[model samples]
Target: MSEGRPRLNTEMVRLGGLIKQAEQALITAKTIALKQFDLTVPQYAALFVLGTTPEASAAQLARACLVTPQTMATVITNLEAKGLVDRSTSPMHRRLRETRLTDTAIPVLEGADRAAVQIEEALAVEFSPEELRSLQELLNRTITALHQLG
Candidate 1:
């Protein structure tokens, strides 16, 4: 509020920093949670996607993760070596292979979910429920708009 000075919203700048901190915190939590299962961040992402879309192809997963199909192939290869995922002919398309979470992966996914919940809870002390929900919705809209631009 100074004369001849540009105005800036302090809240926006603080929120940006919060977003970066949140990303780092979540990644750290994921690393710790997945250590016992020997999964990397990308491997966990692939498993989470496969668990949600049990018949997704590696190509689709690559798109979701914003990585090359070749990169996804390597991630899948690692997951397969760990027995966390299984690949087979898609029931919808015989020529296309579908990837899915294996039975063992279900428990791992559950543990990841629990870890995420714990992270959120630990961060919850900083924000009210309504504020958290509003932040979540805002981020979802931002992501949706970004994807729509592409």
Candidate 2:
């Protein structure tokens, strides 16, 4: 351990492990829920971003979705093939392509959103509103602390 740094304890280690496990569980549940819409988690992430940021570049989508540019490119190609997205030359940057969700994707996203929301609601129901608020604050602080280390 570095000078002035606190030593790790079992509770700290367990907290990290629990966070990872919770994340994996959420992903697995989302994977199963998204299957009916023929969407992968990454695909859903991209669409969810595009829903609010229409005509966004793949690079922008990649950053917003926490994916690499190469991965976003592939996802865009697949979505295009499925008629879920359309790409066009950016008016301001002719060399760049902008992506947007198609009409076909609207209904698919609606259903997927409902399924995802149901999972969130189920989780929220397990905690009191005050507890949920505190958890959210703690998670936000944790994220900020982690980012400060980088």
Tell me, by lDDT, which candidate is best.
2
Query: In order, what lDDT does every prediction score?
Result: 0.82, 0.92
Q: Candidate 2's residue-wise lDDT over 1-150, tens digit each?
A: 689988867555676677899989998988998999999989999999999999999999999989999999999999999999999999998999999999999999889888888878888898999999999999999889989988
Which residue pairs of candidate 2 clash?
A: none
> RMSD, each candidate, Å?
5.1, 3.5
TM-scores of the candidates are 0.71, 0.89
Error of 2 at 2 (Å): 20
Alpha carbon lDDT at 147, candidate 1: 88
Query: Candidate 1 versus the native: TM-score?
Result: 0.71
lDDT of 1 by residue, 13-122 (tens): 67557778978887887788778767777787887888777788999999987789999999999988888888899777889999889899999877866765676688
Best by TM-score: 2
